[model samples]
Structures are given as C-alpha cells and as structure tokens.
Target: MSAKVSPSPPLYTTFLVYCALQVAFVSFLFSYYDIEVGPIIQPVVKWVIEKAEEIPLVKRTFELLRTLVIGDEVNEENTKTLKKSTPKQKEATVEVHPLDADLSYLPVFSSEQLSFFDGSRPSKDVCLALLGRVYNVQKGHKHYAPGGGYHFFAGRDATRAFVTGDFTEAGLIDDVSGLSHQDILGIQEWSNFYEKEYKLVGLLQGTYYDAEGHLTERMREVIGLIEDAKLWKAAQTKEAEVFPPCNSEWHKDSGGRVWCTTKSGGIHREWAGVPRKLFNPGTKTSRCACVKNFGPPLSNYADVDEEGTRGDLDNPNLREYPGCSPTSNSCKLQED
Candidate 1:
C-alpha cells in the first residue's frame, strides 16, 4: 500500500497561529515583570481596541478578558482610579538662602538662663555673649570650657575685656559706659567675629537688647558712635595715602636715618618723596612722612592753591629736619 500524503494548512491560517503564539509569549513576559504596557504599546493597542469595540462579538470578548484579568470593567472612572493609585517619586526642594539662619524664631535669653550654657555641666554647651548676642561656642570647648584660658568669658557678656586686655573679675563687666568711640568699635568687631565663627542661639536681656529681644537706646547710641568712628578712620586712611609714613631704621652706634621710597608705609606710588616732620595741630608731637616735591598736593586745603607746584611741602603742618637738606629724600638723625 502506498503512504498516505498529508495536506498543508493555508498560509493565512499558519500566519494567524504564529501571531497568536508571539502575543501570548509577550503578554507572559509583561505580566511577570509587572510592566505597564500602556505607554510602550499605546498607539498599536489603542487602534486595535478601537476596531475591536466596533465589532459586538470582539467587544464582548474583550470585556470578558478584562473582567477576568483586572477584576473590574474597563471604563473612564476605573481608569482614573487606577492612575490615582499609581506610585510616583518626589523631588527634593532647595533653599534660596542656605547660609542665612532665620533668627526671629530663636528665644530671648536672660542672663541667668545664659549662664547655664557655660559648659560647667557635662550636658550643657559652651556659650558666650558679645554685645548681648549669645553664641554657641561648643566647638571650641578646649578654649571656652572650665579650666580653659578663656573660661572666664564663657558665662558672661564681657565685651569690655576684649579691648582693655583686663581679664580680672571686676574688669570683665559688659558696661561700656566709659569706653571711647574706638573701644566701642572694637567691641563691634568682636561681635562680627563671633557671628561668623559660631551659631547665634539667642539675645541677652541686659545692656544691648531688652527682654523682648529689641535693641535698647544704649545700643542705638553705640551704633551711632560706631558710624562716626568709621568716618574718622576713613579720613585717617586717606591722609596716610597722601602722606605715606617715612621708612626709618636705627642702630646703637649709628643713631637713626629716615628715608622715602616708592613703596614706603605699604603704600605704593610712582614718586619717592622727601622726608619731613608732620606735626599734629595743638600738639608738639610729630612723625616723619614722605611728601611729594614736584606736583600739586594730594589733598585740598583752604590756604593752599590747587595750581601750586610745591606739593605738601609748603603746608604749615610740615617742617624740614634741622640737619637734612631741604630737597633731599632722606634725613640722618642726630642723637640729642
């Protein structure tokens, strides 16, 4: 007997079977990975779903599959609920001013309360007050703790001792009543230094600040004095630039010699000037300064004309050395 011949399936039928197997494999992979196929296959899936919805039999089959897989009907309300339940990651926000600490939330500290943070107890922090502003100096515990060099300043507002070099119990008081304007300015500088180096925790209730952390009248007056001192310092700096201090050197056997240089007194200039004794008004005290000899004065004066060529040499405040030449840029001093 001849062997029976088997007929092959149609091309369309073979293609459909292959496609169904591929889709089943892809669906298994997606389900195992828990992947959201909506975004990856949105366009193709949407078009297929739309066409399937147009056919009553295909639409009913899809509804049956959806109910079996998701335990819900495919509708707009259910889709929105699914999206709402999805997890999302949040991004961190950054501060606009990272260095500036908001001090308004800090509490006002009384003198007795501030004394508790003096590092005497193991649980307490090392603290000190400058101009009524309290700072946590725990990082410098070796210097601010008990038996330390600066331990005396740790528990109190001893701003006066910063400039006076008086570390005695009586001299460590915060009252700056008899201090000069320069000393007040010195206290302000110490406050600035503490603000930069440590954390400001609170305000003290005496002298500079009130119980409510408001500035007292005495503090305002001190601020005004600081401003005036700054102006006076600026004028003195300008005067030094115009009339740079003369370079001086002395030896036991050779006496002394004062000279001028282009870079004398740490002030750089194009001219190496002549040395002269600059006198302070209403005082016999004098110091040597380098004065320009061939140009107009660096500063304006009521008695001297701007068009003069004598520089600052013609000013009444300056006098030539007794033994030195009037045009020389150096002077040899003779021991009296």
Candidate 2:
C-alpha cells in the first residue's frame, strides 16, 4: 500500500463549477458597477470576499474571479488605509457620539482585559478601545495586525493619542478631556471610521465611565461641554449658510440708486437691507431700497458680520450708513 499510495483527490468538478458560477456573479457586479460602490457598501463586499481565503478552493475561486475582473492589479487600498483630519483642525463630520452606541450583545472588557486582545495573548481576536468603546479590528489585519503600523494602539484605550497623534505610551491613556475641541472633532472621524469598518466589541473601563458603565460626573460635564461646543459650531455654520452678510453696490446713475444683496436661502436674488434716499422722480420721497446680487457680501467673513454695525475698527459697520449717497461714493448698506 505504501508503494502504490494515491494522492488526495482534487476538488470535485461540480463544486468547481459552483465556485465558478459564484465568482462569475461577483465579477459581473465588479464589471457593471465599475468598482465605485460608495464608501459604506464596498467595504462590506470586500470583507465578505476576504473570508473565502480560509477555504483554499474558495480562495482559488476568488483569485480566478479577481484575475478575470481586475487583471492582476496590486493595489494598497485593497487592504488597509488611514485618513487623518489634522489634530489642530476640525473635520466637518457629524455622527452619533460614541456613548450613544448600541452594544446589547457584547462582552464587557476591563482595562486589564484589554491586554488580551493585542494578539500577544493566546486570544485569536484583535481589538482596540477608543472613547469608552471597544471595536473588533481583526479583519483589518494589515494595520491592526501584530507588529503592524497601528499595533501600538492595540490592547489600549489610546483615545488621547487618537486625537493628539502621539502613539507613544504616554498618550495611550484614557484621559482625553485635555484635548482641544478641534482635536476631539478630528478623533470623531476615527470613531466613525471604526464604527463603519469594524464590529463593536464592548465598552472600556476607566475614569470617564464607572465600572458599572455609567457616566461619571466628570464625564457628564465634559460631554455636556462637548455637546455645547458642537451645537455652537453647528449654529455658526448654519448662520453663515442661511444668513450671509449684506453687500450694497453703490450706483451713481438714476439719482442715487443702489443694489444690495445678501446670501439668503442660497439664492442670489433681490434683498432690502437698508433705506436708500432715491430721487423718486414721481414721489420724491426716501424709501427702503432693494438690490440685486451685485457681488459677494460687503462683510465677507462671519466674524465681521457678528461685530455688525458696531464701532469696532477691526470689523467696522459695513451695513448701509444713514448718510450714504451716490455723490459720497460710500453708499453701503448698514443695519439701521
């Protein structure tokens, strides 16, 4: 028997045919969609396909499919990626806060237990703690992989470093309240990235969150401040977006006629922001004037508008002044 031992059988033809059909379907989707499935969905398809690697036949099927579809292109984006919105600058991102997570069926991990997830321990899972939440990043092996670029973050609630970009041991602590508003906002993008790219494992134990997972008083206060800052920033953005500064173009013709425009509701239309003393050949009475959008507002910046009509030399009154006329060549709208 040893002399005439036969090799293991090959994959059955029927199974290979089934695998071919499955791969063909994926290939068709790649060809039809042109590989531009937006951010949230394509990662899921890629992750699903990656699981096939555990089975050699299925892996072969995917390789065959990828070869037929992509033509052997080696792309780095196929695996790990990182996008950083600078620490000192705020990223214009808004998503549900990390505390609002829905972790109904995940195991709670203590600070000590987090060490088990670094791939150094026998545990087969890779995870990280961020902003009191744990995310299983086992799938993103290239970055979270053992001795990977982001390996320092593993087995730690390095929330501070996520905001500060300091991946050293000193920054690998739970104290993130000292971070600036912009830094916190920047970290939020990472939070959203993890939320989208990985599965939520559980919550982390620390000062901000009590052992019972309840928000501490300090945490509540800090969160309240963060929320207030977020609201204020949003209000400022909406104010700029909805009500822009008024600009009046001085016109000498038609006996002191002018046009004023302000960006309101996102349309460049007519606006009445001040009283213009027109000759009014028929009535001969001063009246409030409306003007079409001649150009961008006189008060270009929001800060300049906030200082509105006040005597601040840094941001002087740009609204139509009481005595502005065509002869003066200083006819600009100032809020009376």
Candidate 3:
C-alpha cells in the first residue's frame, strides 16, 4: 500500500514559532532569575546590522526603506552631520604695508613731547630716551626723578653722555657725531640695558629715528659703527687668547710690578710666557702681555710650513721693558 505524505508548515509559520519560543525563554529568565536578555542581545544585533551595512545590496535596500519612511529630513540631517564631522580649510589672508609703517605699535614722540615725561610733571611718568627709544623709568623714580643722581638722563636722549660720563647740557645732547666706534658700541650697550630693565614707551623723533618712528640715516651710521666696534672687540679677545695679559700689582710706597704665568689674565694655558709691552695699533696706549718663548705663534698655527722657534717673542707689536731682560717673565715698572 502507498503511504500518504504530510504537507510541511509554511516558512512564515515556522519563523513565528521560533520567535515565540525565544520570547518565552527570555521571559522565564527575567521572572525566575531576575536576568535581562536585552542588554546582551542589543550589542550583538547592532554588530550584525553594522556588518550588513557593508554589503551594497543590503545597505541600498535599507536606505531606500529609510528614505520612504523618513522623507528628505533624514538626508538633510545626514548631510549636516557629515559636514560637522569633516574638517574645513581656512582661507588665506595677506596684508601689505609701507616700508616705514608703524609696525612696532609704539607711539612717536617729539623731543618737546618727551620732555614732559621727565618726572618734572607730577602726573607724568619718569621716562628717558636712549638711541631713539624711549623707556619708562617710573620704577626707578628715586634715581630718575627730580633731584636724583641720574635726573639729567630723564626726558632726553643722552646717548653720548652714557659713554663719555659727561652730564652737562652740551654733553647730554643726542648728537653722537665724531664719536669713536667704541663709544657707539658703549651707547648700544646702554640702550640694551634700558630695554631689559625698563618698559619701552615709544620712539624718540630725533637723530636716531624719524617723525614716523623709522630708523634714520644717522641711526644706520651708528649701527654700522657699532658693528665695526664689535669686530674690533672680537679681534682683541682673540689676540688676548693668543697673547694673554700679564698680572700686575701697584703700591704707593713700593714700585709697580708685572709678571707672567700660565694662568695670567684669566687665561689658563700650558705655557708661562715672558712679559712684554703690547702697543695697540694707531693708539699711544699699551698693555702688558705675556709672550710665548717656544713653538710657532698661536695666530700662525694654521701655517704648517712657517718655521718659528722663538714663538711670539719676535712679533713687531711687542717690546721688552727697558730694565727687564728679554727672557724674564717678570718686570718692575718704573714710574715716569
């Protein structure tokens, strides 16, 4: 006899039965054990959705359904969200100004205007000018105010007097004409000191700066002189290293004495040289220097082929003391 086959249930009916069983199992856990299944299943469902989004067909299908249900608002919100998440490029801006523009943002003061701040006026601040730059010296009112020791320096550009030690009206002038390069360098140092110690107020409209607060031709010349002075000072330092100065001591009753040592003139070296008078070029002044007695001169060390056994003792710039021997390391100074 032929057996009759039973028809299978529909797929939708099977799915519904499986979902109902899962719901019953979750409800039993929640009621009997006080456990919730939503928290554990939520992350898993979200991960599955994220993975499905990677598939183009699934992603497009979901997007189409979402658009039909939410309309254009969702698309506009997504576009705005995308814009917020992305970085934007900044626009470039360029500004042009004249060469003599007031770039320092400091005020320009005339000599007459600067004179008001000399501590004479009770309402004004104590101020002074150096190298065309004005500095407020109110903090040092004791020294810059009226009847003070440095009162003459207030309210004026006394650049020349800083090095010359001349506090007279004629000497306190800003005119630094005919001053030596060393004097210019000294003025520069004083300017640096004021800049570091006090607050810069403005530019002085005088020899160093114009009415517009720009550097003038005289200021440029002074700067050039300062540069030359710097070079000269550097060369002098190098010469001192090569030929160290002698140690000297003076007494009222006893005579003065100058001697040489390996550590003289704050220069520590291996050689204890003999004393000699080193005359500065184009100047009548001279200083005692220690002369090396052996090997090539320190300045000529790079000349490999240059033969010298007497060291710097034979240098033309050096001369022995009148009463001292050529090889002596010490000399007793004779008072003229």
Candidate 4:
C-alpha cells in the first residue's frame, strides 16, 4: 500500500505548532516593537468597550443583568451611602454679601490647584461655598449653629474663614481683627500648616488669611524680608526648583518640603529662631555656624499668643507630629 499520507501531519500536532508560532511571534513583537504596545492595546480595548456601552441595547442588557442579580442589595447600599454623604453642591449658587468688598475674588486651593470664585458678592458665597468645598457640607441653619460645626481641612483662606467664623462663634476668639505682635507671630506659626503635615517649606510660600487684617502686615513683612534675602534662590541652589504655578521658582525637597531663605545679614534669623549655614550638598547638611547651635530647625504651625509663644487649640501646628516645634533658640548666620 502506498505509504499512508502522514495523516495531514496530525491535526493536533499541527495545531500545537501553529499556537507555538503565534506565541513566538507575539514575544518577538514585544522585544522588537519600539512603540509601547501595552498602553496602546489597553486604551484601544477600553475605548471599544466604552463605545459599546453607549449603544442602547447594550446598556439595557447590562442594566437588566445588573438588576437581576443584586438589585435590592445595591439599592439598599446606595440609600445607606447617600444618607452618610453630605448634601453639598459642587458650586454655591447663593448671592455674596456686599460688605465683603475686600474679601471678594476669593481663591480656593484644592487638588494642589487654585479655583477663584468671581461674582458680585464673593464673601458670603465664597465662605459658604468653601464650607461645602472643604467639608462637603452646604450652608443652612444647622451648619450656621454651634452643633452643626465646620471643617478647615483645606487650610487655605477659604478654610480659614470657615474656621475663624466657627471659632468666633464658639467664643474661642476674642478679636478677629486686632491681633497682637505675639498673636501675629503665633498666627505666622499656625500659617505654616497644610491641613495636617509639617510641610517645612510650602507653608512659607502659601497665602494665609486675615479676617481682622493684623496678620496681613506681618505676612507682608515676612514675605518682603525673605524675598529681599534671596532665601528661595539659595534654597534652589541646594535642591530642584518645583514651585507651583503662579509661584516663583523655589527649591522643594524630594518630599515636597520647601524652605524660606533670607539674606538680610541674617537678622530675621534671630527673631524667627532659624539657623543659617552654608549648604552641604554632599551630605545634605548645613555648615552655617548657626545651624549647629540652633539645631537647624523646621518651622512649626502652632496656635499663638499675643507674645507669639506657641500654644495649642483643637488644631495644633504639625498635626502629624505633636510636640515638635521649631528649634527654640536663635543664632547668627555664617557666610558660605
């Protein structure tokens, strides 16, 4: 008999060889392709699925199946979740009060970005809107009263206004407008906070609020002093410049920490109790004579007294770490 044709090379074996070739081809493509195939393929599949979801029949089928399996459980869970969530609007529609002329053009810093509220009346609306924006709570009689309370997690003016108003109502604040020298410094200390962290550098560059406006003078002075001394410039020389938009190019450590620098023969250094030294890039240390004596302290965010001695409130400076204030001693700066 003629040698039986080799049964078409055995369909099973042929199929296995075909599969192996396919796998090899894919491996080769992965090794040789310059373009990123993973990202390209994933998005393409994702877009196709998204497009398919828009079809009426496909959407209906998905909803029907979804309802069939866990409809009641999902419905109950959704109701419970809704009950726990605050009924805050994304943006406030309330009219701003006219008396807050200077407080208009209020800015909300969120997601590391700024959102400005522009309208005829920005004070009430801005403050009220911030209550919802920061705490996710809308304004109402309950929110206005003591028990309703507020949240200042944003730590920006929007949050500060809410905290100031809340504290004033709580009788914790005697004067919102007439802060003393100590209070001004204490306020400066508190201003260093970013929600709950010891940011080190970001706080000095951030904008703080002043309901009574006393803090404004001190803040301007500090800003001017630091700018005049080219503290930021010096800091930039030590680290990479990572200042935010609308902010000047300034040094930020890898941990998102920033430092404020000043050059005024280092006079402000004594008042603030910060030590200055020649930066040591190799060891990431400071050689300034003052650093050794003053301990090269980071700034604190504490509640302040009229004399500027650090104090505490429901909120403390450097929320993550309590009892860590800026180094208490002062010293003269040394030249590089």
Candidate 5:
C-alpha cells in the first residue's frame, strides 16, 4: 500500500481547474444564446411607482374638468359681459316711428284675420270662413294678438246648434236650452258664438209676438230703435221681427266696460250682459252700446230703458235687488 503514493492538489490550482471546466461546459451548452454582459441597466420600475402616486391628482383634475363642463359652479358671473370681450361681437339697435296725424287715420283693418264681423246675419259659408280665419289666427299666423279674445258665430239657428256641439265636444254643459242657469253660464265660454260681453247687431221683436199676442207699443219702439242704429234698412220686410241686434256689449265691468260685473245676493248670479252703446254712437270706440228709439215712427221717446232692460222688465225691489221673476216671456226675449 505504501509503494505508490500520489501528491494532493493545491487549493488555488484546484479552484482554477474547476472554473475552467465550468466555463467550457457553459460555452458549449449556451452556444445559441445571445449573451452580452457589460454594465447593469437602470431599472424602469421607479417610473411605475411615480405614476401610481399621481393617480389621486389625475382624478381630482378630472373632477374639476367635469364641474366646469357641466356649469355646476354657484359663482357664475355675468357671462354676457365676459363673452363681449371675446372675438365674437354683438349689435345694438332700436326701431323708430313717426306720429303724423294722417298715419293715425290708417285703416282699422288688419291682415291678421278678424274674429269680429259686421255680418250680423252670417251664412254658413261666412261662418266657415270666419272659423277658419279664427283657427289660423290662433295657430300663429301672426303675433298681433293674444288669442281667445273673441268668438265668431253664424245665425241664431247655427248658434243654437253650436250650443249642443259645445257640450258634445267638451262635455261641460248638459243643457242646450239657454234657460238653465248652468247652460247660460256655459254659453259664456263659447268661442263660436258671442258671449255676454260682446256686441251684436240684428232686428228686434215687433208688436206681433211668436208665443203670445203682440204688444203694440213694444213692436213699434223696437222697429224705431233698429232703424236708428241704421241696421233696419238691411232687413227684408217679410223677415221675421227677430233680426239680430247690432253691437251690444255682452257684459260690463264695474267701470262700465265690456267685462263681467258680479254682485253678492243680487239677481245677476255670476254675470250680466251690458249694452256698450245706448245714447251715442262714438262714445266708446272699443265697445258698442244700445240704441234709443222714438214712438209712432220709431223716435227716442219709446220709453225704452237706457240700461238695456226690456220694455216691460219688472224692476227688482230693494230687498230683491239681484232677483227678478221674468213675468213676460217677451221681456226675456228682448235681451236674447
């Protein structure tokens, strides 16, 4: 056993030998890999950390942008003044007019369709045309009026039929006969027929009554009043004494205008019709009044009440100032 003894390898020499073998093995195995080692590259991971820290600021910026876009700020200043400073410009101007007396006499007619008409006895065609005009006027043909101020009606028969039609259309009024208090009130809202405050021009009852015997004085006076208003000539001789009255107010305000006037505990109930003219023709241009009459040949001495009460209309007692029982049907029909 002691005949052949080999010497041990040195620590430095052995380490060098092991490193050489490892290098040779790695070179042979990694021959296809692109391996180049120089200095270490600085990591980009810090940039990600910095971006995460700015998230809150980004969200706050977005919130501020949203508020500005939505106009949610309470301290909104005068934007008009601010916008004027911008590149955009604004113009200021005013219209002018003259006050000549000749210009003042300009015709009262308007291109805008009229709800009023002088045709006291309107035919079906006239009514249809008038209604179409009214509808167009209301539907924005002109900016001239604040619609619903007037109504247009045909003859009495048409008016009566329209009364039924109104209830059928609106289901508001049940009775067509004008005798019921509710029916009379409902008739006031009618736009196709004149209400209680507007004026109407037509013939009046004569001595020959339809329901009862004629009162001689009443007929003559009515004829005289009609003639004075200049509406009688247009009527035919054989025409029923029941021609339409001309230009009388439907109702009156407290100031005697064509507006409703109501009193408590009075017979007026909710309203009463007022004749706009009785004594003069040109007193109130906007509103027409009743006409005066004379006797024998229709003069101003017919004893007709200037206040539009019927010839035989009973005066209400002081206690019953607002109440009256129409004794004579003729008295009620006079105003109708």
Candidate 6:
C-alpha cells in the first residue's frame, strides 16, 4: 500500500486558533483578580499597544502582566491617577475624619501610590498601610524608617503579611482574602496597633478597593472575618476563665487530684461527682470541691474560697487539656 498523507490546517486558521487561545489564557489569568476591571483593561491595553507598538517590547501590556504574574514585584509608583468618577456609586469610601484632632490629619492613599509612602525613601514621608488604609508613621520614624524593623514592608501592600507574620517576599502580598479566621484576627491586632500608635492616613485603592474607592467583596469578607476572629478569641477567653482545664498529678498508688483555674472543686479523674467551685462570699475565696455522686453539696462542704483566678491561673492544668491555655499560660503554671 502507498504511504498515507494528512493535510495541515490553513496558515491563517492556525494563527487565528493560537490567537484565540492566547486571549483566553490572558483572560483566565486576569480572572483571578477583580473581574470588574476586565473591560477597562482590554480597552486600555489595546490603546496602549497601538500607541507603543514601535516602542520597546518591555513597555507593552503583556510585559506588565508577565511581570505581575511571575511574582516579579510590582513595586513601581502607579503614576496613573485614580478617581471616583461615578456620582451615584454606593460603595464604601475610604474617607475618615475622626473627631480626635490628632488622628484627623491622616491623608487617604490609593493602592497605586502606596509604595511611595512605605518608609523606604527617608527623603519622603514614612507610611504604612493596613486593612486597605494608609497611616502616617512619621511619628515613629525610628521604627518605620529605613533600616527599621519593618523596613521589609516598606514597598508593598502588606495586609496578608501582617496577619501571617510572613514579612518576606512570599507573604508580602496585599490580597489576604483567603486567610483563616485566626489569621484575620491577627490582622485585626495589627490594625489596632496601627490605629493606636500611628495616625491614620487614608484608604488603599486596590484588591479590596477600586480606583473610585469602592469596597469589594474581598474587603467585606475581611471585615466579617475580623469580627468572627474577635468573637472567637473572646469566646475562648471566657471558656478558659469559666471552665478551665483540669491539671492532675499521678502517684500510681493513690488517685491524683486535678484542679483547674475555674477553682471548681478538685476533680478525681476516676470519680464522676459533679465538680463545683466552693465559693465563700464572706472571705471571697473559692476552691474546686466535688459533691458525692455529682449531687448538690451539703452545708459542711459549702465553705467556698475564691480569690479570683484572673491574675493567678493554673496553666499546668491548661497544658494538660491544651484547650484552656487561653493565649499564654503563666510562668508559675509551667516548669523549665
């Protein structure tokens, strides 16, 4: 038999197919970000390419995307000015005029220009951003200044970095929408720190916000996540204070008794008696005392002793359960 031959696709058809795939691939990459900006980018990119076609290849939109996509730091000052062109926009604006005169002077910053203020250029004013807002840390020049401890965060949107404690290149990205509840609370702590120590400047302009300062779903998620984190912390604190972990020591021959910060009567690991903290109102003393068979206590065992376990907590007990550690256990509760 003669050798079989296969026909190749037309030259234009092959080019067109690849061209469509290229467009789809670019769109897919951009889909990871705010889809609202897709239309804007397309037109703007078309215009840019037309204008700069004769210019160097490095100046093209594809090159910019390549740089941003490959994690090549997008640290340049985004010179393009952003504005709230929409009059009827109902989105949250990054405007804050605190009643306190001290905090009222902070200026607003769009995401584009955030790097300029990141304390790197000592010649320029020092600033730091959190929760899509900027702050003037000029007062704490020593800490935020060049060579300062946080200088690594000087040229970026470091929202995720603050929560994850990853100040290195890996954790320095601003999009922290994917963090867990605990991480969100971490961000809240940093936010509180900045609010108290530094003066608020203004809101940032990207990721959680648009050019017009309109907040996005990612920003709303952060807000809710922060609230959830705080609530979770508070619930954990109350749990530790009220029903502390039971700490016990075993003697092998005798049953080891366990006591918790709750001061509820010592619990016999083998016994099922409902343990209650014996509280003496007159002496303000409390101790954990168990009633026989987990029933009501009789008059003789009612002498309660309580000094309030707020300051003095039994963390050895906490370490046993690990649930009652509540932030950190006291030094006395742990041995070297």
- TM-score of candidate 5 against the unseen true structure: 0.15
**Which residue runs does candidate 4 get wrong by more than 4 Å?**
1-178, 192-336
When 1 and 2 are scored with lDDT, the better candidate is 1
Q: Which ten-residue region of model 5 has the weakest summed lDDT?
A: 312-321
TM per candidate comes to 0.66, 0.44, 0.65, 0.18, 0.15, 0.44
82-187 in candidate 1: lDDT tens per residue?
Answer: 8999878676432221112234356788889988988898998999988777889999999999999899899789989998989998988788877766787788
Candidate 1 clash pair list:
none
Q: Per-residue lDDT of 3-116 in model 5, one digit per residue for the tens? A: 875555466445544443444334323332435422331123223323423455433543554465445333344476566667755554322211111122222222122223
- What is the C-alpha lDDT profile of model 2 across 153-263, one tens digit per residue? 888788788778777788777676666566766666677788777777677767655666666676666667677668767864554333333333444553343444444
The residue-by-residue lDDT of candidate 6 on 188-256, one tens digit each, is: 777777767666656667666555556667777777777777887886555434444344555655534
In candidate 4, residue 76 scores what lDDT? 80
Instruction: List runs of model 3 lying over 4 Å from the truth.
Output: 1-105, 300-305
RMSD values for the candidates in order, in angstroms, are 9.6, 22.7, 10.9, 24.8, 24.9, 27.0
Best-performing candidate as measured by TM-score: 1
Candidate 4 vs. true structure, TM-score: 0.18
Question: Against the unseen true structure, what C-alpha lDDT does each candidate score?
Answer: 0.78, 0.59, 0.78, 0.34, 0.28, 0.54
Where does model 2 exceed 4 Å of error?
1-98, 101-105, 235-336
* Candidate 6 C-alpha error for residue 276, in Å: 16
lDDT per residue (tens digit) for residues 17-36 in model 3? 45544443454445445565
Instruction: Return whichever of 4 and 6 wins on TM-score.
Output: 6
Clashes of each: 0, 6, 0, 11, 34, 15
